[model samples]
Target chain A: MYRVKVYVTLKPSLLDAQGKVVKGAAVNLGYDEVENVRIGKFIELSINENTKDVNTAVEELCSKLLANTVIENYKYEIEKE
Target chain B: MYRVKVYVTLKPSLLDAQGKVVKGAAVNLGYDEVENVRIGKFIELSINENTKDVNTAVEELCSKLLANTVIENYKYEIEKE
Candidate 1:
């Protein structure tokens, strides 16, 4: 099997409202050193080893279902299992 | 400055409904090689270098705000930027 770890994050150009809220809360909680924050999604997938072209399959999954390419960018790492 | 990357994931014992749904969708889309899927959150925080202890502050943030320790587990990496 192959283990794929994907990270989907919003483009730097876009505003991350959720991260902003978290940063505000962090500051309120007295973490005055916080400067900026960004939030993203992390997905892990287990795939059968027999699948042809594991890399391509994972790329398709990320672009088609895992990430909203218009606003978010995704990258993944594959490891043998 | 310091860049902290945090990943919050549901405990392995918990059911991941969202990931299950996505796996089903992937199958429907013809990527049957998928065996299992799990989803989590990835957060990035930029902190000032002057912070007394970046590690402790991030640990507190994860346990107190970023993660539901009862159901989720979190880990982080810190890099000087």
Candidate 2:
């Protein structure tokens, strides 16, 4: 069996309103040391396949359907057990 | 200073092509136990300010910029040292 970990995040140019809101809340709660908030995503997957040709197959999947190349970025690690 | 962590993921219904590719690769690589791959994002931010009054402000910010309620999901944690 194999496990894959993926991460996606917004481009630095885009504004992060949610991070700001949480910052505001922290300050209000007397946790005024907080400054900025940027949010992103994390995903983990388990694949059932032979380890021989998984790399190329995985890359194809990433380009075709896994991530939206325009707005988000993605990276992944593969582990075999 | 405070740190915020955010995670975003696809709403299950959407296709995860990246995951499929990874699975295929694993199978070919002779690691046939791999099954699926789901991709997501992770974000970390630090705020430098008085710890008071940050909560409300943070929530407002989240609603305005951080996450897209229509598509993504988010959560956060605060740490003080």
C-alpha lDDT (0 to 100) for residue A67 of candidate 2? 56
For every candidate, C-alpha RMSD to the true structure in Å: 0.5, 7.2
Task: Give the C-alpha lDDT of model 2.
Answer: 0.62
Write one digit per residue (lDDT tens) for candidate 2, span B1-81.
666555656557777776567557656765454466565557676766564665665564454555566665556565544
Instruction: Please provide, for model 2 over A1-81, each residue's C-alpha lDDT reduced to its tens digit, 9 standing for 90 to 100.
Output: 766666666667877787567667656766555565566657676756555666665565555545567776767787777
In order, the Cα lDDT scores of the candidates are 0.96, 0.62
For each candidate, the DockQ is: 0.91, 0.38
| Fraction of native Cα-Cα interface contacts (under 8 Å, chains A and B) also present in model 1 | 0.85
Once model 1 is optimally superposed onto the true structure by TM-score, how far is the C-alpha of residue B48 displaced, in angstroms?
A: 0.8
Off by over 4 Å in 2: B1-34, B37-41, B47-81
